[model samples]
Target: MSDLFDLIIPPNPPREVMADGAMLLRGAALPYETDILTAIQTIATRSPFRHMVTPGGYVMSVAMTNCGAAGWVTDRTGYRYDALDPESGQPWPVMPASFLDLAVSAATEAGYPDFMPDACLINRYEPGARLSLHQDKNERDFANPIVSVSLGLPATFQFGGLKRNDPVRKFALRHGDVAVWGGPSRLRYHGVPKLKDGEHGTVGRMRLNLTFRGAL
Candidate 1:
């Protein structure tokens, strides 16, 4: 009788995966993908994407822009969050409602509720572009979680321990996936490996990543 009852019950829905303190909310952002893309299009029109130069004078391979109260910028001076766009000399576009709502929802689902992000860094990657492992320590506080949403082409995300030389775990992040990390994993080193050649129907041969954080 009990076995028959079990057979009739449906299986549980997908749940978030935990790696260290990081939470991988698979497919959590799918419902908002269209809206997010639309918001990106509007933001790009205001502040076009560009490859920012590092303080060391090397240009980043990934084209990046931001939408929120603060935008991340890198140059000879160093990497820091500024209220104004260095390129246009105007304030970065406001964070879209869809972007902010998705971020908050993902964070809450990952057990970090009330996660209000004041900055959303948008990264565009074409074939062969890659980001080296680095820690996000520029933020004013580590208490807030970092919420990253993946869209378009799939890519391998390299998540490492606190140390730069620590071994990394590569996770395949697909469109509409969201990864959240905070608390113990707040300062962990992470990055994306070189994107392989691929064609995404809506986005073409590229990938877009939205990383939301609380920055003063």
Candidate 2:
């Protein structure tokens, strides 16, 4: 696929296999792109995005916030999901209907039906920003799959095996692409390489990721 053509106007993306238990639904989130961005804006107004500090004392390059019953957070205290925003001292913003609908639709398309994610972690990445490989182990259950929606600039998504040293596969994820992993691939390690400089018409010079998980 031509990256240039995909950047401008993508053909309706079809469901493709990324791994044994992972599926990539290309352009699945296009219909909800507008609503999702609007919802992100609304969520940010309430909880806001901040570059969180990891337990190791390193500041993350990706700015993050959340909307749902709980929000994923990290600091010197270690990583965990909290019901309230540490900054606001109030419950994280409620997950919007549009967000819930899109997530469920994408998840269903990827063969995971009835994916009711209680937490939506929003990540913003600019040039030079990256996410090291990690697993979503904070969740209580691995039965539920992870449904992630990508928007704005393109990114290099890395997926590896359960062990950190396991061989990694790279996937080019563009706006509107949704990746869902569960079952055999639930404990896979994944991350994003540093984003290259690019300007997206709607999201500007950065990329936004909406990662939904059952973090109860």
Candidate 3:
């Protein structure tokens, strides 16, 4: 059978507002799915995905890797961006042009016209994987929007206010969807709930998220 992507992702994807500065562009990345997936595979072959450890000594549930001028990493020392992959002692793989184009286009659509991402953090989530509520504050500049592209199984996304106790709005992030948040919502707390079991035609039994940011 075909991937059935055409049935899931409409030609005119709607942009749903999540907050003052956040939005969900449904099926925004559908057209470039094949090319984006190819780039991810190539990047993984070089840097590979691994569960990172937090400074508190807890192992993260999500497996991650990256590409571009810098890569986000966490260890006993602390959470921060590193120009070189700790595992390889070399700079992370260069960001693919396909990826850059997708990020820039998505950001522009989200109202951030001058967004130029320096880091592409690729996260892989398996069944039962969960990401706790956290702010994306490691980036040096908050003016650039965070462009997150979803691939594979659908999962519940959490978007909340600046404080941890703020009420969170939950929504499903389906395959090929792109989420963007910046400006007033740049430092907002957000995360994904535990992933459920499922198989996607393009990405199989797991979810792949490409989060582009200005890490440098």
Candidate 4:
């Protein structure tokens, strides 16, 4: 297990990757922290945190919510998107302007201009929480890029290739970092390792991750 992360991969983000797809734009959200936080607060009011159960009945350590045209969900039936929040039995919270703007901007920079993501998955990870490596293939369209924004306590992100055993790259994402990927890299597997216990001035002992995608 240690060998899986032994490779101290550097963040050698290439310009072409930024122009085509799959690029890490460090600190892209730093300037918009206030706006993003406000958006999060608004969404939380509508769709509060809930620990979703996986198909295996294991409770996910992360609490999640969503806002947009569609929202991602995982249950005994498997991972899928629904227009309404299953918990509230109503439509998911509306996507805030700030969230939409960031997704669009990040996608455009990654060579998918005019991108307007209709699904946003918000995950809140606390100490010891980790996301298993998996592909974001449940979305309806693979052409649309995935834009992820990181905030609060730092976490190690595992970015792999199309194949499960493909060499993986790691990066410590801090608040305000944005990762955008699509095109041939849209199906790459990725996840986060267990988060160490630590508190952030704004987010406490947790990490916030926003994933924007096109669902319809």
Candidate 5:
């Protein structure tokens, strides 16, 4: 004897989904998405996002910026974390409290408590922009988990095995989804495919990703 509305609604609440050692917290960031976006704008104002060139002398399609004690950067010297912005010659903008809280909360929910990320990398992806499969190993420690939050346009996330050639599983990452990876799967290859054409009210034709890491 259930009502019509009850019959159409899901009985259980959304929960975290595990992929190997990685955990996907669906819709976990929805509540703080607006705040996160505001923080991004503020951070961008201090440190404008720009497309960085790889050591191989190729310009990246994804424009990126960072905020925290340490920021990831690349150039002829290769990938590494720096305290000062190479572009501005000043220290990277401070990590927003909202960004830190969301990252810590997501990691805690994924079973890694007391997570403190020293770096928050913000990546902006537009239509036709993509990131190839790669591991997050630039950090000094592999024990710390990487928490990534997604906002705006939907994109297909590729989570692969330890090796680049290993089989990959595609996950549709929508707005407000948070993905955490550590432990045994810390070195697994992961990347996003080319974004499709779409216009989100807030982000327009772009997808913003916040990846928190312990880079010190």
Candidate 6:
């Protein structure tokens, strides 16, 4: 496996440490690009998109939705995880096989096998959009790792530590990239910098991020 990986993704970037608990695996999901993009398109139709209000009373810059048994949400109350989509008062759209397969395969490739994610957050960022650094602490199981896939235009990912003021590492994530971290890195803070103006043939002037997790 070591030899195979070296041959495939030669010179895997330094495993850049972003914080005490965060690391970046660049282009980790390039091998499964097609399946991930198809999955995103399939789920978008059912759940659609909407800008969610943050707890701070400001609306998020990105449009978001979810698929799977649980979904991540933000509103006047604050950010949290829920089993149903607040918009329709129904369960978030089911996780497509394509999505699940790609996620598991990516996770497995990252040394995490048999990963079963029950929540998949789909975030779309247009030019000038950004996400604040925050921890993914809403899941019932902190033991489960996070598998995040990037598509469309590239964006700089800001990975931080457990605290807000912690130093952060920026990763320029492009289409077909996957980032996976867990164990000691599960609670690290992360976000995306403002997306630059650009357009892709399929996703247009936007970047899509699919984050898979096990939300009780």
TM-score for each model: 0.93, 0.94, 0.94, 0.89, 0.93, 0.86
Ranking by lDDT: 3, 2, 1, 5, 4, 6
- Residue-level lDDT tens digits of model 1 in 96-208: 99998999998998878978999999999999999999999999999999999999899999999899998998889988889999989999899998999899988789999
- Cα lDDT of model 4 overall? 0.87
Candidate 3 lowest-lDDT run of ten: 1-10
Q: Which ranges of candidate 5 are over 4 A from the true structure?
A: 1-13
Question: Global CA lDDT of candidate 6, please?
Answer: 0.82
For model 3, what is the alpha-carbon lDDT of residue 74?
97
Q: Report the poorest 10 consecutive residues by lDDT, candidate 6.
A: 13-22
TM-score of 5: 0.93
Clashes of 1: 0
Q: After the best TM-score superposition of candidate 3, give how far the Cα of residue 137 lies from its true spot, in angstroms.
A: 0.5
What is the lDDT, from 0 to 100, of the residue 83 in candidate 6?
85
178 in model 6: Cα distance from truth in Å?
0.6
Q: Please say which candidate is ahead in TM-score: 4 or 6.
A: 4
Clashing pairs in 5: none
Pairs that collide, model 2? none
Per-residue CA lDDT of candidate 6, range 1-216, in tens? Answer: 999998988785444444433445666666666776776677777777899998888989999999999999999998888988898888888998878887887677666786799999999999999988988888888777898988899999888777889888778888877788787878888899889999888678899899999988
| Candidate 4: count of backbone clashes, pairs at least 3 residues apart or interchain | 0
In candidate 1, list every pair of residues with a backbone clash: none
> Candidate 2 at residue 175, lDDT?
95
Error of 2 at 183 (Å): 0.4
Residue lDDT tens for model 5, 1-216 = 578768898553356555656899888888898898998999898889999999999899999999999999999889999999889999999998888889999999888896899999999999999999999999999989999999999999999989999999888899998999999889999999999989988778899999999999
Pairs clashing within candidate 4? none
